[model samples]
Target: MEHDESLRFEVLGPLRATLGQSELDLGFPQQRALLALLLVRAGRPVPAGEIVAALWPEGAPASAMNIVRRYVGSLRRLLEPGLPPRAPGRRLSRGADGYRLETAEDEVDLLRFRGLTRRAKREAATGRPEPALRHFVEALDQWRGPVAAGIPSPARDHAVFAEIERELVRTTVMAADAALLCGTPEHVLPHLGRAARLDPLNESLHARNVLALAACGRQAEALAAYESVRRLLVRELGVAPGAELTAAHTRVLRQEVRSAPRKRDLARPAQLPPEPKQFTGRQAELDSLRTAADSSAVLLTGMPGIGKTTLAVRWAHEAAERYPDGQLHMNLRGFDPLNAPLTAEAALRFLLPVLGVPGHRLPSGPDALAGLYRTLLSGRRMLLLLDDAFDTEQVRALLPASPGCLTLITSRRGLSGLVAAGARPLPLDLPSTADALAVLARHIGRERPAADPAAAQEIVAHCGRLPLALAVVAARAASHPGLPLAAVAAELRRSQGSLDALGDVRTAFAASYRHLPDDAARLLRLLSVGCGPDLTADAAAALADLSVRAARRLLDELADAHLVDESAPGRYTAHALLRVFAAELDRRP
Candidate 1:
């Protein structure tokens, strides 16, 4: 076999001709189109009639053969410039039957992609799922953008490329499924989510999502997936879910009950770390949360680690008295970095057993699960703590219909939807100076106070009276028992070196800011640059040079994001640390 690897052609994005490392610039559009047609046939000779049909689908021109010869001559001269002086024919030779463009298989990305996909399928059929997943991922990586992204071809060829794109999507879902079956939902969830979005009507993609969600322990969300699929099928196709999907949904809802209790629940309970010693201030905030819990849903929105979860858990423990049935807790993994978000179906599965429902009896869809959950808690009073929720959709599906059931949702983003849905929102602020000092004194003994009251006050003010910051500062002081309070205050004054003062509190602020959308982030940066303790919507609008209405909407979005505190209606202010962070971000390129 004569091997010619130097010749390469790319037809995916755009038609290109190259010889070895140097690209051959085929100047004429007709010449480039002719070369693409030749490459598609690979080593096989294509009859002149087929070539004419491909170029002119409506009908061939009178001078079609002459035009083809002219384009072929132009392509050969452009692409085969380095070829040794030939004796009889060009590198792109015209046979009596038609024409042939020969190149090695390795030179084409499309052929390589197809080869890898085929190998993956073979590996999967042999039960080597792990290897199949790796191959499929490799094949996908070969695609830089959509298939034939920039290429303009005949309608027939375009149809062929579209079919290839669809196949690629299917292959991706299969790979994701293998990843899920291999016990790696975190790795597969992003792929599945992307696939789901790409082909929203694909039932297989939705089914794969359920498997991935269940593997991630988000069983409620898994069940919710089934409901979404069912609804889509009914709405779009006027059909119910297939038997396989219904069976899978049933299994997920019952998995928890069928499984035995985990060791932690049965064995001696593992002692939790002692509660943070200096949880001061927020008495009013706590009372408001309790009151909201008594009525509709209570959403506690604040900067991350701002003790939102801490306060929620504490209140749940305190209010455990009212909830005779029991208190239920779930960390929804709302802000997880590597996994798909927890869905309502998965959350329902976690909750059903707690409500004493048997595995087989639990509903298969979010609506059904939610209805059953409400029915179980209809008469009995219960407290639910849903921590780290991402969005309203996630929380809304899991909400209990019964007024007797009280829910406390802690999220970095303010649950505006919850508020609009008649759930009360209790926003948390940084602790007061006195509260911060008390927290510090509680954590690090009061001996230092008599020595330097001024220093203690200074430390509280410098820490911005944020409880998380004060706790960290207090912990640092407690760890160094002999350190003078004045020295600690001096360290805090040097903000750059005061890592010990902020600790995880800084992380909380960062988390909340990270969740803001691009527009909201821009608005925040402008707000941080402008003067005043707080700005009205009009002032904020002027700073960004946006319309008053536009700026008002942005400000509301920021407020809903919890990055900007709504001190008064239509007025907003950033927390001290958040202001500093936003200023730093704005100054950067």
Candidate 2:
């Protein structure tokens, strides 16, 4: 937001970056901290000695520099995937001193905060208190927690982080003083209170917290704040409230600060689910979704149980802040076993009321309700997550007319019609071996998987690296932590032709399988008869006892539902789990 660029680094919150509305995963803990350290000291080259020291405070091992080099290489590729082998990429560069991360003006959130603070100071110098306070509020708003929030301990307490925390405290106290000048001290209360808590013994901050709260007409809260700080100071430092704090107490007693009327706060619907728990991997798809944010809508399609909903919901959470008006989520139930897909009007009925529209106020027809929804979101910046949608028409009905809003839709079928329009198509595929192992490790600790890599590979293979399947199987293993991963892999291998161990996986496949046209379903079942890695259209036709042209059509239909992958032109293959599923069905009547 500060640089007006699509991609920027954030240091004030989590150790991460945002590319447009999408947040990039900055790799593991240490790599994230490294990025944070670079951002904190951006544009200044640090010697390798400083890098190693900051990363490992106690001591640097022999492999520390090599590991740092490896992390640097991985980060370069992550930030600029297309860079050539020997290229240093756009952000990080190596000089004689060591490595440095550079940024344009206001490209980092910390830099943006500093810039805002500087602007507020200038405004105050020019005697524009209101504008000064506005800048101060924005500057304070930039903080989510202490700098580089997700960095692990020890490194998190490094002097670099301490320096940033001091900057936060200074700004918070200054903003509080500016708040008094504008008579809207409430705007600065939260920041002041947080700063005071971070530095309880800093009487200046506590005094400002008290004065700000008192100025906002909350004397009781203000007195409580003073008392809390006083006790903390006494306990921690064996010192009572100092002069500034005592003066704050005296002013509160005399009611010297004039109170301002509070502004009414509007509640916006934050309807996206709680951040998609244990969301494992989809970095490329996430990057695609970020690019697709330029479009008003993006369709996420994959076979059932491939985690289309999880990926969409995860991306929605990352981008939710961009849509300040609100975010709306609805499961269209396109493939629900127990219920029919909600019609356009029915879905609108569920949504419009959530946006503060009365039920009785909803229009009678689909077109009318859609019109009202579009009108309500006419100029608003909002996010609509249309999950499990049946088709393009169902999605188009609920889409906002405003360009400022973004819609993310997930479905089993490709929904090519929307893709034919401007919407980007993001097909969520199974994870790679490493990512699949990571998913299992997230549920069951890394030790089990790390100990038996081959067994872990076998388990992922049997599960076809499908996220839902891996999650279910790994969750069972996690429930019994002492269980051997080889035992789990052996069980999965023994149950090869059935999803008995994964009833949920079977259920997900059945939901998509049941929706197929008769010919396509039969072809899928006959897919079990093939022994090669994949089959040509003519070969598949021979197996299914259909004409080559007819087989091609059915294959296309099955591909659209993601039941089969057309691995090559005129060739196709089912995922391992799907093949076994088809084999089981073929054995049936």
Candidate 3:
């Protein structure tokens, strides 16, 4: 009955509340995150543990529950001023489980978004395209950015938020479909573009974009759109366009006619693995890869389990557009525990067929195969990801001659020989604290880490920012959502650099060790008990009781193999996880 709106809330982007025309400050980050969580639940009672967990992602304080109580009271006072201390709130209510924000569907932007989306779908299903398109656009307008954008990064990245984002993508995709059906393709272009950017590899979304462009009479743009996603799928996912996307391409080319001569595409293999899900961190390295996208080859070298292959694949997918001919991948299996390093001959044998060479018609021997391989790629622009190469010689036979091609290689070894021949060496080191947390967030779950930030930091610090270690910790924590990160950190601390807590990262280190020369292997074990953190070449001589020359030579060998890092001019350091691994080997005798 009131002309002035009494209350309104927004959770489509940053959490917000408004009384009449004025916006209310949501107080600090914790308070804002709290409100956002409740709004996401949408009037359903959130449990106390869930609230406490989400509010203090790093870990709740000793007085965390009390702080939550106080924050709620303050929020209530802010929402309904001039109320008595013990009075119940009309909008914010406490229930048996925890708390909930009571608001009508019209009073919250997200609720309105959901309502409009349902109505839109219903409208379209019932033969009402015009109104359906309107509902879709109206629903999409609710989002300003990522949901709960201004809150804690973990909360902003929570699974619930990710689901909301997925819903947005679905809606955007549907909106584009609706626009074309109703003959208003131009109207949905902006939303379609936004959704496409959010999920560049989504074939369905890109398919709709292509069709919509064609529907609007921009055939050239539509064809380019098709090629873009086609290349994206080929290079990033290692698969050609699925039926839906290919059908869309077919529709665009024919322009509502029965048929046209199908365009011929050269047989190009899309051999890349699926893009890694929730790949976190490594921005600096990703940027470096971007800058070096024009280069013929880039090497990602680091200790075992440092995520070199993951980074290579992640970048390959991102850089796929540049190489429309195709993408090819080979796991050299350089450090596989159960198998020998894939021979260059075997690698060539595997790769030739993937490049469209017939297996029976393939030439025998590495030289002939390598030659044919180079000739096949000579004129084409392509992307090659040679994963887990053992040595320089192992990959040299596999390098292509085309300047138009880019090769990405991942190995634990530095592959100095390849570097001398012009491979841009990108040594993937430990992730930054922020990126480490992001990695944890990506693997485990964002909400838990956000709840106990200190515990999250402890886990990162204890894991030494190694993506592999973080992933292990994340896997454990993720399996048990209610397990406090502090408990995880405490468990890692108790392991005392033992592999018992870090999962199969120890197994990964063992592969590199198994392939090490005897002298270098012994030196690695002795140094774990030697003055740790690092050792000079001369100091290594006294510790191992070998000549300084022998220790120095073995040290360099170890350094080249990446069992130990060359921390300075002549000094070397072992990673904590590696140190533990070495100690385990030392104790075994």
Candidate 4:
């Protein structure tokens, strides 16, 4: 947080003292702007006219140099309160050409980050992925926020620093990819996930996720990762999955080779799928998915009915075109109690033929089938969408070794093991306020009684912005045209009487709850007995008759289920519908 140290400044966040770590309170706007300009031109001299132009883009005072000198003098005095008496010619000198902000290379974090990234890139180019990843991670760790957070300058050089920040992200991703290639997907997943989240729109990260996932034996999960990326690209940018991603997906589904025979040859082209009928919010979640997709594979993970399947389906449809060979979609009923989760062998038995492998020739053992699957995809491009994966074992049997393929996997579990194998983790939650309202408007029509702007807002808010709840409320409103939004909101507020009226309304929350561990399920039901805005770890623990640590762990588990939202760092809250669902579950059995 310290901004004052040496002459060099770090502008990634709020302009802070990077040199001495001594905070210099530059009171005036002009003074802050002036320091920003110099920081951009660190280790170099900036001409006086350039400084004037930077400060005053349109015009400058005739005595700009004098004014500039005065500001510089003030900065020097402020920065160096008690300097040693100048030797012969050392009195903050100015010459005919321009003024210089004298500083060492070590004075700036930006400079340090850039230096490290550059080294990492060089190492990667030389095939030293391990060292490269290390340097890249070290450089990225220096960033606290956006580049030049509170400072803005009209100078072109300032823009260069902005680009550098972006490049830093690119470099960080490259380093993480290198680490994955160097044989440690698990080690790099956290770093890759963090970087991808920061830059969700980047396609390269999504591809990286696919690679990582396959490498870690989560092929089905890898396919799900691809679907998530495709959805984000379509929803956020209205763009289809790029050729690279489609080809990668194809490679995975077809079990393509790790490296293509012709290194420079692009994957075969594919056709894009139709766009979704209604797309609302989920900007942040989409970004997170995109980030995960940047890896070789990702697990689109969350509790049931939190739209994991919707997101996966949407992404698959959008990304279909990328895999010209074909888009292979499958669901492994890992969580269905009536039918046991499909084994790797059985799932492959169904998928291999869709991928063009003959049933008569398919391998018998899970490992053999997976090997054949990879062999089939070695040289081609394909996309695979694996939904409702049960565990790492089932998913691992389906992964292809080809780096050219993309895979997207969805699961209720956290699946950190998939992450260890380089699968990006795209965690899902409830819809945002805007998205929830849109869902209601879609289901009930914009002119419904509950569709009044204020009422609609209250309905969505009361529904906790959960998609299922929004859909149900909208359905109810549509069925009863004259029902007031206030009435629906009030009905939702009453837990005991709401369930029967809800009927199948509780289905989504029930599905999510069904997946929870016994202890977590018990705790969720217990916590539902309380009524409040949010629950801190302590409160939740007390409700569940657990110690704080145990309670916190349980709350986090609930969060993974998408039944509880982590409202703050250690605070949790259930959606209105989820609360009702839990209360009903508590009364059951």
Candidate 5:
């Protein structure tokens, strides 16, 4: 037989096996289940009756034996293709009582993961935590995603996988603890952050996280992390924090914990990125933000590339002195095309240290981290700019628990869901002609637009009066001082069919478009192909061949996502750049 003896099997995230350079196909749900059941008990024969029970626990059919035999034959063919027909299977061989999968321990990813975890634990117990920490990292890195992500049932609930997953979590916490003991807790904060989410109710992990945070000199956040555990325990389990957690909280309160040295500690973080040099107009939106200043949170939602971040950053700088503690800024990267939206836990991991938690002392779980964040900000007046939010759930976990901090969140969608959380939504629209002209004047010389006033007005109109589009036009004009405003306007008008002159406009719109639900995405494409300047529900229905009721619901979704504007009741129209991007999608083969 030509089968590779070094065949590898995996059950970490999915059921997969590969030999040499080729991936072996594990066919059919039942056949795959049978293979998983046997592999978990490799080197020991699993009875035919046991196999049937594991694969179909409810009951077994009369032809269950025949089915198992047939599946075994199929799996054997794939596992050892060069074997002659009817030849005794070498990899999967029938025994006197049942069958056994002849595989070595090192050939399986699960075995390797478990082995590293055991070694890490042994090293930690021997007071050699640094080595333990390295093994712990290697063990945790084996997990590709959730356990048996898309595999059929029973295999997921199998005893081996469940035990290993539990072990992985414990190992992760152990590694963090080892790092803490070695005075290098800062190195394992990311791992602890992930494990804490996986096992939120684990009090030992929470205590360890708090200690690490305190060790980083973020005493305020450490105290808050303990309080988070106390509240969660009471709210969910109807109990108080255990002895260790209480001790950690008390130590943080008294400032007696030994914290790691700070390389560059700041009195307060002023992390806000620079705003546009010459921001123009949005007087009305700025006014609304001033009104919402007293509110705990304010959401500024609008279409793609519509100056949401610019407006928020500008206002943050303008009101910098109002927040005496400091300013915090994070681009949630929610609408980023290349990267996944930042999760609440990951965001807290980054923000907590800046707020004063020592790198080693940051909370491990999102809830705990958020609690620590809130505790640190409880009495301090701070400004938090959470830019490019994806949805309410993403925003909810990141909101400060205290009202002393004011959060400014921006999203490409309307985020109506945030209204329930006391967030006042201020939806932004295309800039007015006057405001658009001012933006152009700010970029190009004011005298240039004033010289050819008619052409400048036509340019803003053609760009749909969007600040982003207007800025694109202004940039092209600014690069060539000798170029006339009329010529720049002509280029914008001529390039309407393509995004060559739009400058990141299509890329921005595509980022939001990809996040839409399937029905909304399809409707967006159809609207580009068939809809008009202003479409009523009835007209939209005819264009997409959907019922009026269905079309209205889709339009409402589109409106929520800021993909289209509801000019009046049941009337929708997309921005010029958005329409161009959508039309481009429709033309795709």
Candidate 6:
């Protein structure tokens, strides 16, 4: 409601700005184009020359500067109604070489859309489906039509249009994924359907649509959707539908349904796996989890190999005795390389049997299974550990609608979605130097590290104090006790330029990197070339040749993925080994 009074700028559908209950007239076509350009580069200065080029791509007259100045004055007056004729413009300040539109983050719809999407992504990663679902829906709803519509310029050209459209399709697909996880795939069908019509060649959307259709029990419609995509791909690109779509079609053809078991058949399940032998550090995080023992859900998240699962299991093992009934554990495998994440239906199928319900008597659909799972857990005191979750939707379906139970989740993502659903988040960080040394000692022996303190410290620091990396180094040291601690440290330094020699570190880091979109991945590779131990957002922008705002957004994304650290705002640093890995990736042709 507060946003209603603030100035609202729209670019997804049209070029329009409004204040409160009235629409502000933004002037003629060229004038609107000028406004659109400024809005696109909001919070940053746009040089007069750049503006002139964008306004008239064919050519610009000698009076372009004068025309741009006049347009700026008019926009300033419209944006800040109280400003005097000659008074320095408050909203649109004139810089030495350009003008900048100073506006709040939420004033522009595009900015709001990005903010919402980032939050939704964090939530999904954190395993809070309800809020992730809400945020994704809100973010996707911002796209009314083509970006910068009705503007005549490069802004409306296919090149610019493609970028915005790609982002829109990506968001739509992600929202649909969340919906499916929340047992409401039907809600995203219409949006996905419209997107599929616009992007006929996007096999990913088509595959998801088929899955959604099948999930909703419309097997015929699902097959038809597949056929439609197959025909379109063949006609437009002279190729068949890809494997993902083909698999969806195959699944629909073999669809089978089941029903939930009677309450009498419900069984108490204790299925927690073994905790890591060398679990170290995380005293603070473990304490936080202990404090939230009464909370219905607690989500533990961090970057890949930060030991999210280790901490979750450690805490679960510590708390196992409190829940007398039993414990339930499942690895959702959200980031599995060979297999896609387990769906809510599949998860329930695995879980129901553990809870005493036989496979034959389990519910036929995800929604039904979720309902039955909740019904069975209503009054039971139990522990549910949902590990390696892909997003909030998958976690949501698996949550018991019970106050007496506690659900613990581990993920490589932040999972901001869980916060709205009353999940307490415990983001795990790399271990302290002391903890890393202790872990090494646990693996080998404290005698070697204790004999030479400085060399031992250097070894852990080179590993970035990450438990997994430290474990690898420790294992190597254990295999050759004759080798000095400094030798291992020297090996890490010598191999800093290459990641392959680091052992499965490549596989661990690549799993997280492979999930990023093309641009994000490219930016990371670029950062690897330009980066030192640490760099500010401005440095990143200069290295990548992107606008400051754009670089900052990308940096924030990298930080969220745990590829970089933003311990100090605006400054980013990557782990020593991660930087090497990124650099190695960029070197590939």
- Summarize candidate 1's per-residue lDDT along 206-299 as a digit string, tens digits: 7767766775788888888889889989999999888767766766776731222221232221112234345556788877766666575888
In candidate 6, list every pair of residues with a backbone clash: 122-416, 123-416, 123-417, 126-415, 128-418, 129-392, 258-364
* Runs of candidate 4 exceeding 4 Å displacement: 1-275, 287-294, 449-451, 478-497, 536-541
In order, the Cα lDDT scores of the candidates are 0.70, 0.83, 0.83, 0.68, 0.79, 0.80
Clash counts for the predictions, in order: 14, 0, 13, 64, 8, 7
Candidate 2, residue 126: CA error in Å? 47
Tens digits of per-residue lDDT for model 2, 1-589: 3643366888887777976667888888888878888888888887888888988989889999999998898888777758898698878888899999878656788888888999988865544455677898898888998789898776788898888898999988877766665456778877887887787688888888888887777999989988988888788888888788998899888776653222222236789987877787788889898889988888888887888888888999999989998899999999998788889889989987787665654545686466456645655788989999887888878877578889999999898888887788888878888899898888888888889999999999888899989989988998888889999999998887788999888888888888888888999998888659998889888888889999888999999999998888888888888988898899997
What TM-score does candidate 6 get on C-alpha atoms? Answer: 0.56
The list of candidate 5 runs beyond 4 A from truth reads 1-266
As for lDDT, the candidate ahead, 5 or 6, is 6
- RMSD vs true structure, all candidates: 23.1, 26.5, 26.9, 22.0, 22.6, 18.2
- Residues 1-589 of candidate 4 have per-residue lDDT tens digits of 6554455467656676533645677656666767766766676777777778877776787887677777777767666667544321232345676766655556777778778888988865544455676787787777776666665445433555557656756765676566454444555565556656767888887777676666566789889988988899999999998976787687678764232112133233332234556555677876666555545576898755667777776776765566556666677887765567899899879876665554654534675466445545554557777888878888976765556567889887777778888887788866767677777877777676344677777777666676766666677878987888778877766644356655555754565567778999898888667648898888977777889999888888877656677888987887666677777777777
| Candidate 6 error regions (>4 Å) | 1-264
Which candidate leads in TM-score?
5
Q: Write the per-residue lDDT of candidate 6 for residues 70-145, one digit (tens) a residue.
A: 8888888898888899787778888796888887778888788888999988866655555676898888778787
lDDT of 3 at 422: 96
The CA root-mean-square deviation of candidate 3, after full C-alpha superposition on the true structure, stands at 26.9
lDDT against true structure, model 4: 0.68
Model 2 C-alpha lDDT versus the unseen true structure: 0.83
In model 2, the runs with Cα more than 4 Å from the true position are 1-267
The ten-residue window of minimal lDDT in model 5 covers 258-267
